[model samples]
Target: MKKFGILVVVFIVCVAFLSSYANADVETEKISLNGSTSMEKMVNALKEGLEDKYPELLIEPQFTGSSAGIEAVLNGTTDIGNSSRYLKDSEKEKGLIENIVAIDAIVIVTDTQNKVNNLTTQQLIDIYTGKIRNWKEVGGEDLPIVVVGREAGSGTRSAFEEILHIEEQCQYANEVNETGPIIAKVQSIHGAIGYVSLDVIDETVKPLAIDGIQASEETIQNGQYSLQRPFVMATKDTIEKQNEEVQKLFQYIQSEDGQKIIRAVGLVPTSNKMSY
Candidate 1:
């Protein structure tokens, strides 16, 4: 009987030791993210916070168009694709799932030299669609309007057009590839007009009012600003099912801590439970 009891104790000890070892040896998750050049600041914040909290985990992020992010998810090239627009029906059909991470408002801006503080929605549409060619036509100086726009694939363009019902061709003098470029162009060029997320608004340019409403956090939260869109995280079925690291990454993003990073970058958090 004594011998049997000693063996049982030894077996329990070995099981406990092995369990501890297994937990200690658990590998850190590594995830890759792509999409939404507009998410530059937010993604950087995410990287900093995530590394601080879980140094064991690794995350790689890339800036491409939001559509490119969705495609990356579908192609299994990325764990999470950041998108500034909602996922399309075709994307759902292709086995991609979208997780809304934040809400952002599209802000229309003009060169600081223009002195134009306000524009109605129709006036902005007319200006960008080339209906109004001169800044004087929209309560500004008598300068010809230099329309600036994002590239065709930009989620900002899609969301802006959709909100404005701007079916006309983009009548821009130039098409910039990213938000930074657009902001820079608008800042440097007098009579220039462009749009970007409210987070990117700076003193170099002036944000315009739409339909008497400003693109501000309060206005966006109240739905007074009509150009709000959901920023999403995309994942394809192949990666969701087959990639353990990808799954862990999504899980962490949906967690409370992740929402804080989302808000820190000036976008509205999707999760109310997550503290700002």
Candidate 2:
């Protein structure tokens, strides 16, 4: 009877140890990613691909704006920070490394009913800076041009304004907080014109040609399209210094399989031999 009791106690201890080890393993498999609403589709696609490839791995993503995402990674709260624009000098000073995984075009969009099909670089600058207030000024109808834009700190907004040299000069009638709402607002309004990531554009809104160059993989890759920006997955430290799961995520992003996923989502992968 004494021997049996001792054997039962040993068995219980072994089971408890195994359970704790299993829980720890599961926790280690999770990789947290936060940032860039613009990169949401690409990140989600990569998340699904990674999970499918390594069933034990889990990718947790949060679609806070790009600046917030950078702050999260800087504060050690996330494994990756997705930014549609390149990191600023101030951000780079804080030890964050910019990893350009893909190039994204910031396409200007308007309502489907709008007659305007293109805008010269100067015309785009004039329109956004409040110089051209009527769509008729740019060969559209006589309706008042409603400027739709992303809120402050958005990567898409930052890139759009910077590329046009109209930062802080935009006469925005409606400032939305996310990319989806910009698309929705532009779709619903007759004179609404906005900019969004090229990957996110759908039939809901019509994309405009900038300076006679349509936003496409070829135009953006060849420098013909000037409204493009880098899709950055930022890290506080080098990939070699990150944890196993974080390292694996970055590795997969650079792999051929990952490049396919990037292209599949309408983003131009860095592997396309284009200089960033």
Candidate 3:
């Protein structure tokens, strides 16, 4: 009887140890994503979908602007960097791989109270370049145009400036940090005009048709939207080289189901392609 009791106790201990080890393994299966405030909606959607598919896995995300996110991945601090803009040639030369997951339109927004509904590409350029300062000049109210923009190191700002070919020449009256605040700032100020990712568009602000082209997923996919940029999920190396959890993430993002999530979140899905 004593021997049997001891054997039972040993068996219980072994089972408990195995159970604990299994839990630890599951707890450690996490993928950390950092970067791009503009990609918040899509990232959160992907996180929810990925976690639902693989219950044992966790996705950690931090929206610390595009530049900071890219730096975090390059320094080995994060598994993936979410960039709303294309990776620069200099960044690619440093072993960062660009995985274009989606395309997002950068909508030019103004206060809903403003009567202006369309802006030519040159008019937008003049507005940000300090050449067009009054709303009346653009067929709006007599209020002065409050040009709002994203802060430095922001992927949205980088892409917006690059697309306009007006790098470092923007005359912003207010430099907001995130997409939400930019929208709020534009909505509150009667003459404010700002740019934000299309996914975040709400009824509070009016989206102007750029050169008679409205920003939409269809327009972007069909190559009619001029103010669009790639939504990149950058990795330090190739997907095959990443750990199992990270590789799983890339695989899911490339899957048809993942494309559904992208579309659901208002981002245009891209081909399953990666560039270094």
The best candidate by lDDT is 3
What global local distance difference test value does model 1 have? 0.80
Model 1 clash number: 0
Models 1 onward score TM values of 0.83, 0.89, 0.91
- How many clashing pairs per prediction, in order? 0, 0, 0
Least accurate stretch of 10 residues (summed lDDT) in model 1?
Answer: 267-276
Query: Per-residue lDDT tens digits of candidate 1, residues 21-120?
Result: 9988978678788999988788788788777877777878999999898888789788778888877899889887767767898888888767778888
- Which pairs of residues have clashing backbones in candidate 3? none
* The 10-residue segment with the lowest total lDDT in model 3: 267-276
Give per-residue lDDT, candidate 3, residue 110. 92
Model 3, 1-276: lDDT tens digits are: 999999999999999999999887766488999999999999999899999899988899999999999999999999999999999999999999999999999999999999999999999999999999998998988889999999999999999999999999999999988999999999999999999999999999999999999998889989998999999999987888888998888788888989899899888988556642
RMSD (Å) of each candidate, 1 decimal:
8.2, 4.5, 3.6
What does the lDDT come to for candidate 2?
A: 0.91
Q: Please rank every candidate by lDDT, starting with the best.
A: 3, 2, 1
